[model samples]
Target: MTETQRPLLEVQGLCKQFPGVRALHQVNFDVIPGEVLALVGENGAGKSTLMKILAGVQPPDEGQILIDGQPVSLANVNQAMDQGIALIHQELNLAGNLSVAANIYLGREPKRFGLIDSRAIRSASAQHLQAVGLQVSPDTLVGDLSIGRQQMVEIAKALSIDTRILIMDEPTSSLSQGEVERLFDVVRSLRDRGVSIIYISHRLAEIEELADRVAVLRDGENAGLLEKDQITHDAMVSRMVGRDVSRFYQRTSTPPTIDSDATPILKVTDLVVPDHPQHKVSFEIHAGEIVGMAGLVGAGRTELLRCLFGVTPPVDGDIQIDGTYTPIHHPIDAIKAGLGLVPEDRKEQGLVIDFAVEPNVSLASLKAHAWLGIWIDRQREQVEAAEGIKDLRIKTPSADQIVRYLSGGNQQKVVLSKWLVMNPKLLLLDEPTRGIDIGAKEEIYRLMESLAESGMAILFVSSEMEEVISLSDRVLVMHEGHLTGQVSGGDINEASIMNLATGIQAVS
Candidate 1:
């Protein structure tokens, strides 16, 4: 790409304001043909808001968007698509009940006449899927596919459009390492075909790998733009956060205490579920310890967490809390027993989007705000919610701001705050850092450490091998619902963990 080449999309003086705060402050950005422009920002930095404006999910309160050097108005999603702009959001927009082909060709299905053309749609969808390296049958229902496959279907849908500029928001957040590589390949092919890509992601490595130019946004404004040669992880971090974060991952080691040898806080024995009956699972997590669960997708990692959290009942198992065995038949049982689960899917299960930030943060411990046997104490709730927001560095105009308006990272913080209010003896975190920016991820890591130091037992589950290895005191590798192996001390690493996860017997 040369400096003389015209940009496919140009945004100037973009601004968006809500009731109390300005979300975007005269933001300016542009994307050129056949180039990948990485948009880097912390949560609440207005990246999503800007993208929504470009995609016509919302119109900008101020500024102009030029397509091919001509001012244009994107009134709605349909108009945006007609103008060759497509956006794949972090939360998938696909209907799980529909087939892959149907989802890809959803509203714009090809028709021979004025009637439906299922055959043509299926054939076109198959071609698009192949272009994106997705091998799933076009007729397969999207709900049955894994998160990674569903993401591929989304990319395939975008590819099927005559997209001049595509916005991908955290596309690889849940994808496995192999799947990420495949996605990168697809992106490269799209770039080669002269499609401009506006890539928004938290994964710095992915940005470095796929972006031709990196643009940093801070406090709703364009901080700076660095060419590929000048872009380093530290540089991008400093730009996005306005401070040097050299020790982001460095945690002060707290020595194991006398209570470490005491009774286990959470004990799962012979836990079995209908979806995964291959293994009789057993694990014990003590207070003041962070136990990590590592595995590939479909290895039953999530199922194990779900069962323990009472989202799915264990067919046969004994759960012991504080030396007393108990049966958990529902989530309420787990909650009453001092167990807090921060679910993997924030939008679907963890958050009530329509609710305000304060309400969402105080959800798990709302009973604490009861003034009497009948009345709810709004003052106490607001106080606790304010503390949570301040403690977690959650950016919002006010505690009364709707959670749906916050960015992905801020939303995750609200979820964490909801659980933290309970002050549980045990915490179950499944992909806690999913879709959050690097700065927010660092904050979450520090928060985890602080919680552990406070004698809270955390069972952390993540697909990222590095996160698992860096944060876990003991790594439990799972394979097809079975405990494949356990890595402690020096035994935990990418290669060693991968060996156990892939059934290559290195533990023996």
Candidate 2:
């Protein structure tokens, strides 16, 4: 509010550089003691780099960090933590093999008589978890818990520390609506108690709900900061991309016109995964149609997609392509059958970060670039990669640029390009636009529309209700692993989807 109420955390002249790129450029930002300051930008805009510098994961090439108005140098993570700075990265870093309590109080476990006090640690962890409104047992294994619970554990771990500043990077990306509400409550309580939070999220709605001030970054520089009242979604989008972006989910009004009696490209009858036996899913995707899968988190939307892609074997189901039933036992089998899956977790499941963009896009179609004696044709590979990069509008220095260096949206495009190279008859896209900026999201939506227009059968899965309603010709809603209802045309709005997803109506 005033200089007298100076921010508890001040960053000035922050600069970071990699081999061929300047990741961050003289970035300056501040966070008040009792307010949520949102750090937002497009992928590779240096948001993560700046946060990493603050967390001591990376040292800034040139910068001054003032904590409580006193200059401090953080050489490593321990030093950062000792200075009361805690960072929760986008990727969960918990020890899956350990108990939640163990993971929470990992290095700073309570000791009694020169021995680890397991009971004390568990009790403290439980209390911190409860403070965050998470109802998970301390003894539960981290891997055994859902992604949402694992995220809660991460937050609880941060709270267990004597943290003056908490940095959360996309904290609610994987959370359901209910879980997000609980997280917001915890964040509010923490803010009232004088904890400075640097909230980073792509969801503009969440920023409006949680952030007191918003700092925008673009192309490794500070664009500007907006007060809560002045920040609108449109303004934020423009700031992030340096241009005004229109409606992100722009779908055509033309109805899908697949031949009514045309043979089904993909037919799944009584699909049931072992983990989800209750879901007796049956669906048919016609060639040249984009079929939308709409539902809430844990509504078996992703699970169904996985089953269709053979990520997991379905216990009782028959998959037929072009009127011929085929048994798919693994992803390889599915791919051979002209089916491609763009998994939900693009970073983990879709792309190999350490590899270059060319390799990633060509990974699934290596055979196409192979020569005599199983030797890879480097020239052919480059040609294919270049085509994909241009077609997908992937922003990279070149196809040789590592995917790890690309932005989130670019990485997603690479994943899509990878599958597109396979020339699949059926393409399964799960939450394709998650964590991407509005401009990039619109580009992806356009690509999907174009692909469907090209006579490719696409099964689109998205958590955004508006996306589902606008993009899909037919919407199938699932609840607790069961296909509860299907809506076509105008009936695919939020209310109808919610009603079906919550089991308020029967499938027709």
Candidate 3:
């Protein structure tokens, strides 16, 4: 950056260390005023650490943070806000039961005659909401709004506090396509008004579309920075991974050979998910095939998986494992029928983050290895953990390392290890590589390929069009709870899948 173009926010020699993990080390970056600075990184790359430090959620072990060329003491979140800085986390932090106006002015309401000025809050909230293009009434309950509208409320809340530097962390991860476009419009408008934004997202397409410049972090350090002209997908991925992952997802497993009368590994015959019971879905996966399910955020893909895994009961359906009708009303029944699921929110549903890596790996299989069906089998757990650590290349100092302390990629590996140990006939993966870095995603893809080659049936869901197209031998497109199209080989392009996903096409 030119000396005359002074940065609005600057970090130098920043460092953060956790037990068995160095989150950030000597990280340095600057954000110019009125510019949207995109931060890209792999899991455990220290992006979160740096963001936390900047927002004063945590103090760095060593470093200097400057605002407008002067060092500042941001010992707390309030102090950070006092300096016109605000953070919007990936999962929004908003009270659902409160009204929009009340939520916006929470903890700092305007007062008149020693009473809260509700009218003033509503008027100010309306202006802020308009600024972010939210048309909801100020008195609308926050809980009643859609996820996209709630996000706008978050931005409005930041504005209510007179925020100048807004940090958005994965803001679009939950939004629909239309919502994302509207958000981009608001971001550009904010930048035009001289509001500096630090944008964080794993969606490189978004970075390319919105960022004036891109800064990449790898292993808790600055990997590289790219100007607008240099902000291609390949450039961002290469920097984030410290290597070129141009061939990002390649399916190496050949198609499974099956006769017409062969019994498929998994068959869903007129399966009815409770979320979309009216739309009966039917599909089947052969023993060695990898099937990809692609759809929009509310397309019922996740619900289908939940039903198949017995997490959510289906309304009416027949699930056949090896051509035998199996009723999976509970997770144990699904497990006994040789099925496993790695949920999208691996942190909450898949792994016990506070527990050690070894325990997480053997969690699902512990019952099978237990002695007398009641006693814990310590020896089997230890052996399984050690093998998983080595086989999955989980980067941990030892088996006892807490899953929470591991990088996003390693945490995901632990979750996968849990299912792998069960040796299930059919595996279900929901957004398998959602929060991981490109390198880790590639590793997971390799594992999937290897598993498929070994005759394991795999069904996976992905929001990323690239991942769905490149990894799956067959793509099943879902729209509004309906399995609209099944594309394979020569017909599985983005346009075809999107046509079905958007309800413009159907299998019939």
Candidate 4:
């Protein structure tokens, strides 16, 4: 930042305290106009508290906020909005049953003849929507739109309010690759128009690509600040964790092949989901092997995992467990056949957020705690839940704490814990480490390594190229619902994976 150019927004000596936690500790930060400022840290590092204070959702215990070098008090969301500050939450805030136009101008509808001017609302909303590259009719229901399009509507809403500084929290956490690109385009365009943005995310690659400056927080304190040229991965990691993370993804140096005498835990022959009958997929995961599935967004990696787990039955296929043919027409059958699956969306598919941690940990193994097939064995349930909590190192005040109160990483661990209680011979993991920080990712990686060492077969799917290359013993690449090729050891690189994923290379 140059001397004459004052910051668009600045917070000095910010502090926040919860019941037993100091969320933020006299943190200081600033953002220049028309620049992308990335705020990064591990979970519970006070990023959310600072954001809430800035957005007027909560008050800081000690701080002064300045806009254009003038101090201002953000008493509430309305007051913050009056100062041209708007926050877009990770979980979108929108009335899905209402029309797009109604949602945009919800409380501040233009008046016409002492009544809501519906026609004017639609016309104004269309212009704002166009600004965000959304061309749909304003009268359409928000519920009918995809998640990506709904995000565009959110940006449109902010634009309609004449927002000068935008705070986006994990905006791309649930978006696909194409949708992320579209969102990035809109963000860059907004920056070009002199709109400042505070972007918070766990994805380091996004920070490297979009941030002009990076501010990292650790343990409720300001760790360090990096300008555009200094924001490298190692620098960010070193500051965030107070140590060098040079070997974050360190792997075992074992050979990819399993022992010749060992049996295959999972084997599939001519597997075909109903949506992709044209492709004949076959693979085998042997004991103690970590096999990764790599592909593009629509390459049917999840679909294949679903078929294998009996969430979606294969149209024509043969599944074998320990060299014996098995029929898995339902998830219960798969569970009985010694298989467990951790789905992609942990919140929606893998966990019941309303339930407590203890109950969620033992949900999948409830049958194991049945008393004479009538009553649940409470003592057994508690014992198992405690064991899972200890083994996973889940950060919770108590086992009775609601799962919803945990961080994203802890919630994912709860999901995995439920499956781990089953003692399945084969485990299927879909996007295991999505939306988690480096520390949590490393913990999960260590858990996977320990599991593999215990003679379990792990088949995981990851969209991240680096994760696949580092974690997989052998990787299976898919393209347009077909198994394109397989790579192991020295052949596992970005070029090889992309070529197979795009259908430029076939299995040979």
Candidate 5:
């Protein structure tokens, strides 16, 4: 914000264009030494494109990058690093087979007598490792370290390259609460030592806690900029979405009711998973209701869903649908019993990236397309796939286009389409919008509302607190493999959720 002095990093008139998208247009920003500039925007808002350009992952169509008041060309990642700029991706780029010291000095190991100097590497690695507050030995295997520790090693690797500016993209998305706190300490220490940082994340709370200036982008343009004092949840949301977000999560329908005559569509009684048999959990979701399961990272929320979907069979439990006990011992059994589960990792569990859109849509319901109990009915498959594409508003070149070619949002829609055709009585979503754009998130929320209105029972698990609190009609809080409490109406705030998730009795 101190503009009288020349900024350490400056971007001017940046533009990036894809085949069908103008990713960025005349975008400009600057960061002073030791300042944390938070780049925020909805998905598809050009944030990633700009970051990629800065990191030399790709060339910008038009732009000027100034480092220390001198124009420079970041022709490649190495060139950027030579200019004292380093990028730490969300997915750590450490080699699991290598040792910590080897990873830190992978390509640039010191040489002695025409051989790699092991002592020199360990000694230097120790200094950088201590700079990031990591206490692990330099010889520790990178794979054996925890995710949080791996992230620290990444920072040490960057510092080893004489980095003056650091760009972190979603650094803490996979970290636990304790890990996040430790990471924040490292960021603060680095900032104090005069390393300018450009932090990009969807979590506004992180930006508020760490950033000195907030830059917001919308639809590939500069929406607004906020100084430290001006950054608030409402301000950021409004600028990111290009509208007032007072009612962003407002419900369209009234709260669902369950009277004495109404039978629950999805019921779990005394469920016990193999991992934690001592904790007995129970919950019931009625037709036309959307129930949200809220908990911390290890609070058994996803485990419960896995048990319900038969991904991990329950050790002991009674699952009933429409007042009849239904035994689900495997994924196929759950599918046959009119249940659909969208796993947390879409790329890993929910999708086959090598397949085409039409085939992916019909993957879960192939039984309906089977002919004579042997051959597939291609024509019928295409018809249903086309119908699903139209209903889901999936943007693709054609049904034959590979699903891997689609955007993250479109890929998720394809995953949903696969199960939607089966007309499952109960739908379970685990982190449905995990890595998608904000626009896609809003679309998914609307879709969930529509499905619940049409009498489908919906239960979803989310790590994001705001999402669970705003989207659910009722929230079930879990703690350490147990159902801690239920929150509804006036008791759905973060305080209450965190209280119940940490094993404290909720006041409500």
Candidate 6:
């Protein structure tokens, strides 16, 4: 794309090493003016390391960065900004307590007569906000806005610096479908205006839809590159992992028959979630079966899971685990009733990032391993940690290693390990593979299949249609807090799920 146009940014022989790990080795890539270049790789493929080096957050051990054919030293973040490069990290860096205009020009506020220029801030902030197509008042508090709107504000703030090169890291990981479409429109507008965009995401579908050129990295080295026309799903997957991942969903056993007379492991009747008390939902998930819950964003899928797990108690319902009625008034009650929940935002709900893996693994089952149900048992905790790590193939230096330092996928495994301690009859996974890379996704998919085969009933909520289709034996569709329909066998296709999700087809 615009190959004749001189490269706006070029990375040459970039090398970085961190103690025992060689993060990048002679890595090279370039971006032309006004194009979306997708940088993709698995979780530990040196993507974050390279991005940090480019943004000047960390200095490269050896390398050269060039802008318009001239080498430049991005020795510090301020220098990177001066050279027109800005990075929007996955975890947003906005001061939520401040106003929109205040956040846009947080430290670099315009001044009038040596005083903070409130009027100038509002007037100029409006233009940048419009550039990102974010329709919000400059006086609006950042905390009051939704996650999608806040993301737009971050882009607007970057534009305030007149950024010519923008790097977005997993920008849509937390966004809804409508929000994703809006963000794509903004990216297109930025590219059309001669601003080079470096888009990084694990979602290959997004790369296929948006990228003009895709650069794949593997194990800290350049794997391959694909031009616009060559960016198919198989091509991207092969390049990233150096293999053709045709069978992404690893299901060895046959799918369970949904209509079988076998006893259901978990059943809910007249289940009324606190968020949507008007609707009463009913569903059943059998032992050794994986049930997928499909619905549009904000359709109360998460709410229902929360209700089932007792994060938010239901207004009224009967939840039976293995044919026993369990009225869960709290999360502990749910756990006692043989239930475990892996919430969507793992960092917040699942694991304590600052804590070690061993502690998190035994957190839920502490009493079970405790002596006289009083003091904790350290030896038992270690055994549990070892088994979990070995069983899940978790990659970590030691059980004492802080979980925050682990890759997204490994961190997720730690979360799952925490729940495996309980040996729940039913596991509720909300957006199970939300932000992890593809390679990790395969591991998790295999784990789901394995767990189901081992007789654990799984009820997972997912926004990815491919994931639902691949893993689910039975599909339950929801619309506006209502259980609208169920599909099994060949009926578990995208059209049926979407129709049921949108309430176009409801069960009689």
Which candidate's lDDT is highest? 3
Cα lDDT over the full model 4: 0.89
lDDT of 6: 0.90
TM-score of each: 0.94, 0.96, 0.96, 0.88, 0.87, 0.92
Question: How high is the CA lDDT of each candidate model?
Answer: 0.87, 0.87, 0.91, 0.89, 0.87, 0.90
Residues 1-508, candidate 3: write the lDDT tens digits. Answer: 5864799899999999988889999999998989999999998899888888889899999989999899998899999999999999987899999999999999999999999999999999999999999999999999999899999999999998899999999998789999999999999999999999999998888998999999999889989999999999998988887777875577666767678898899989899999887899999999888999999989999999999999987899799999899999989999999999999988889998899988899899988989999898998999999999888889998999999888788998999889989988999999999877788898899999989998899999999999999988899999999999899987889999999999987655
> Of the candidates numbered 4 and 6, which has the greater lDDT value?
6
Give a tens-digit lDDT track for model 2, residues 117-185.
999998999899898888889999999998777888888898888788999999988888878887889
Pairs that clash in candidate 2? none
lDDT of 1 by residue, 396-430 (tens): 88999998888788899999999988899999999
RMSD of each candidate relative to the true structure: 2.2, 1.8, 1.7, 3.1, 3.3, 2.5
lDDT of model 2 at position 16 = 92
Number of backbone clashes in candidate 3: 0
lDDT of 6 by residue, 269-346 (tens): 999998888999998889888999999877899999999888999899898888888898799999888889999989
Per-residue CA lDDT of candidate 5, range 1-508, in tens? 3454569999999998775557899999888889899999876678778887888898999989999889999989988999889899877899999999999999999999999999999999999999999999999999999888999999999999998999998898778899999999999999999998999888778888999999998878999999999988788988888777663466788667779688899889999987789988888999988999988877888888889999999999899988889998899889988899998878779999989899999899787668876788789889988997898888776798777656677889999999998989999999888867566788888899999999998999988887898889899999989898899887778998888999986564
By TM-score: ranked, best first: 3, 2, 1, 6, 4, 5
**Clashing residue pairs, candidate 3?**
none
In order of listing, the candidates' clash counts read 0, 0, 0, 0, 0, 0
Superposed Cα deviation of residue 397, candidate 6 (Å): 3.0
Candidate 4 collision pairs:
none
Stretch of 10 with least lDDT, candidate 1: 247-256
**Model 5 vs truth, CA RMSD:** 3.3
